[model samples]
Target: MNEIILKFSKESPQVKDTPIEISVIDVQPDYLYKFNAGIDGIWTTIQDFSEENFCIWKPKIDGKYTLMIQGKKKDGKKSFDAAAKADYIIGAVEEDIIQSVNIDRRELLQGEKLSVMVETTVKPVMYKYWISGKDGWELIRDYNSENEFLFTANEPGKHEILVECKTIESKNNFDDFRTISFIVSEIEKVQITDFKCLSTELLTDKELIFQVDARHEDSRMVLYKFVKIDNKGKALCIQDYSSKRMISFTEREPGSYKLLCMAKDMYSTEDFDDRAIIVYDIKPYKPIVIKSFTTDFTSPQTTGTKILLKAMVEGGRNLLYRYMIEGKHGEDSGFIRNNSFLWETKYPGEYKLSLYVKDESYSGDYEECTSLEYLVEEKLFKPVKIRDVALSKDKNYVKNKPINITVSADGGNELRYSFIVYKDKEEVEKINFGIANWVNFTPEQSGEYELEIRVRDKYSHKDYDSHTFIFFNVRDYIPGIIDYILIPSKEYYMVEDDIEIEVITQNAKETLLKYCISINGHPVESTEYSKVKKFKFTPKVSGKYNLEIYSKNIQCKEGYDEKKETKIYIHEALPVTNTKIKSSLVKAKRNEEVTFVVNSEGGKDVCYEFYLMEEENWKLVQRYSKKNYYTFIPFISGTYRLLALSRSFYKKVSYEDYDIFKLEVN
Candidate 1:
């Protein structure tokens, strides 16, 4: 026969040695009494085992409970009662629920704290808890209801947490176990930055101060390390540094220096990793000088001034040195000296001065430098003198018009000459002829004329001492007319007439004049005297008449010239004795043809006479005779007389003066 027991717990497996307890209860009367290896067969009769110990049942699954058995011995003995079946009703129980197993954090830092928790539920009751690992858990707090267990991790790694449950209270059998595993981890790490320097990259007798950075979450100190790196990447740690942040070195020889730096956290308490770097070299530097430079100072009058010079020096530093002088008196004072120097002079004759320079430091390897110089000059200008002078036309005294002044210089071309002419103390003419002697002038008014001429010599180079002056004048003249008269004089008989009279004065200076001729208060055309100063006229009829002349003076240059008036008597011709007739013969058709003709001898105031043989009276042709000749054609045969007679102006001449001619018929 077998026995069964149940128990519970909520602590880790290490705190308590076991989790359950087992004991016998009651057994059924039946045939199953087989017992082996501490697990027993089904119990049947309580009375049959009441004298012996009962067996335990280890519960591993869920199901309804009953029992049946056949009685058997460890040996081959058997009985029929042990084979009978037994049935009993037992209460069902569940395994404790292991709800969760987990770490408090997924990630962890260096040595920070971490935790693990186990959560569970009892199916029908509470359970015992335990964890399996190298180091046991540190229990923090506990909520005991057979449901949860929490603990802190002492170290880092995987651990197995477990729980077990049973129906008995003792520390053995009929129990169940459930488990889960978890993990933990370790911490973080450190580095450095390269060094920086500000001095010239190629060093020549120079030193440097530098800086670098350390990289870690914590603060730290760095060490400076300097080394000389060869052509390869291998590193060597150098120790003679002045500071972790800065250092200086004196350059002795020329080569390259390699460098490094390192840092560590103060908390790390150890030296930092070697990682920073810097590199460079060293050589020589210097400069040079110049000495003793000079110029000249004396000379002659026209030549102006002079200059003089001298000097000494150094080499490789200057390589090739030069010297120069300029400004006032410099034209005569310039010169050049290379390498070394000596005394020198110039004759440019100047008053202002200056100097110039060049050397080897400025010119590269193979070339030399060139130098230049300058200076200013000075001078004085002079004037001239004039002696004898003359003119072309001479007057009784100084004239009111232009004249010539001829100047003569004893020094000739050596003189610079100038001239001026004055009238009544006022300047009228002036001229400059450079260095020449003769010049001319014209003045406007009559006065005491004064002429001045000046002359200068070239050798003195100045007008302040060697110049001369001279003086003279011109006279005025007025001209005149010699002969005079009116033109065309004698009057005989009838032809038209004109007369012009003029005055013949020696000097008649005048603008416009007027003239007239008159007879007894009426106008006529003649001059009263043959020498009248002026006159004019024309005649239309012939007669004896009185003649007169008059003139008005407009303007005359001579203040005393005169106006004019005069008279005379004139005679002209009557045409009577000078008369003659011209005739033309005509042939009519023969009914007794007849004609008459006459030419008149008379002035404009005249009429013609006509006498017919048949008429007792003489008929006059009132308008015909002024033509000098007349003609008549008679219708019947008869004799006629054609006569011309004089009319007005009879008192001035003879009235018996007439002309007659006859006419005949066949």
Candidate 2:
């Protein structure tokens, strides 16, 4: 029997063919072969030159197992095979291990597309390239078959491309793979480096300066837009600048505004970068214009009335406005020196009103003038004046006489005069004379009379000019005083009541006098009065009598007699004192304590009887008692009376009085 040997670069003891000493080149091969029988007719050869090294072995038992290597002939495959049987096993390993998976890009920008090229060297396209965490590797353009793969980055992030390669084997299959890491960073659509305002003064024809930077892994022509904001802060239409470094906004109107700069790559229109700037227009401020001026009432009377004038301006201008009044006499200043003015006229005349307005920012004098014409007349509503006022008592009046008043006015129209005669600022008489030259008034009552006579012109409205005088009313000077004194008595008189009232006068005075007699303050008209002064009367109702006499002269002046009273007490029998007691709810709770009191009908401490009665027929609580007062308390709730019978000190005074009282205890 003969044995065969195989060799490998690294040891694998599972194989039977072991070689004693194997060459480094022959140890790892594209394929391995084995034999164990005597040689019949097999020959070994390297069929194709595909891998770096292709080995063959023809083991035959002509005498023993033998090896043959087929590689480059000059390298002497026979010499290497003879040494393999001594020490090496037939194991194979790949010579080319994947060192790394290399990618073209490391970082990518957002919304940017980039083509990535993958490079690797392994036999027979040993490794399939894959973008890790995604499906199979996507080929962008087929160049160099699958040996080189191309892909575009869709997102910005770190990514891995995995390369898996396998080496062919005779007995045990073996493979090797590795991963390459890459990053995709965010990218700007436009490359505007210096997007800023060049100068604020040139904002009307504003110029924007910007620069595009080509620092990305991919180069692309980009479109940029420069937008300017109006004074209202609204974004205007975007202005396109193709690959331009400077954008100008000369088409914009004059004002302060802002500018926004953005950029877009020709490939990706969605990506943008922005910046802003401020602008101001340095134009002169225009003065506004005055439009119109007028008044509330342009026509006014000259009798001390004020005329108002108002001035208005427009067109956003500052104005100095004033009004002046010029007439035949002279020009006069008005109440206000600006805008609105008031002019007062002294008398009935024609007047001129001139309104002037000036742009104070541009000139020191007025630029606009407005004028109005006004005619003045005597006042329609003048105050009334009273003159030539006379009273019937010669203006210096006597007492209690009919007074006549006359009032007249001098100018204007015929007037309706109203006369109010007052004794002391209080109206004594009122007379309305209809459209008269003069008015007459008579005072019915005399004192110090103040006459207020007001005359209002029929055409004008006015009142109150007064003529006042003082007078006295003497009693004897009045007509009605009794000349003859008469004492008359009534034809009939009752025995208990009689009185006489007398009438006296110097002439046949028609004055009626009233006489009254009263008991206390109450009148007793039922009592008869004697017609004569010498007549007599008997008192009926026993009480004090008061006589009051009242008279007045024809002038309505009051004269009265003082009260005369006489006291009399009448007695037909002895007077006795009666008594009673009063209280509410004598039986009550502890919080509602009870109190009782006795009441009497006469003077205190008179002799009387004291009794306590629970049932009918009261018993004498005080025997033979002269005391008029007593007190008692019931132990329980019941009804009782504490009686009192009092007698007066006079011989005819004796009485019985009793108080019924109820007691309650809680």
Cα RMSD (angstroms) for every candidate in the order listed:
65.1, 46.7
- Candidate 2 ranges with C-alpha deviation above 4 Å: 1-292, 312-319, 329-338, 347-352, 358-360, 364-369, 377-666
For model 1, residues 567-627, the per-residue Cα lDDT tens digits are 4434354444455544455333225434444444544455444433334457655443334
Instruction: Give the 10-residue window scoring lowest on summed lDDT in candidate 2.
Output: 58-67
lDDT of 2 by residue, 1-666 (tens): 122244544342223343233233433344333322211123333233223342333221111122343332334345222222221112233444555555556666554544433344545444355453232233233212354555656555676665545543322322444556777665654444544445334433334343334332356566666666777878875566555546544644545656666666654536554334545353223334544455433354436655556665653234566677777544545323367676556677787877766554544455557787866677765434444555455433445455555555554456566656665456667777566544444434445555555555566432322222333332334444433334344433332544554456432353444456666545674322222222234557545556544444444454432222233332322344456655555554434533444555554344555566654557877643454345554554445555555544333344544445555445
Error of 1 at 29 (Å): 57
Error in Å for residue 230 of model 2: 15
Candidate whose lDDT is highest: 2
lDDT of each: 0.41, 0.47
Clashes of each: 65, 59
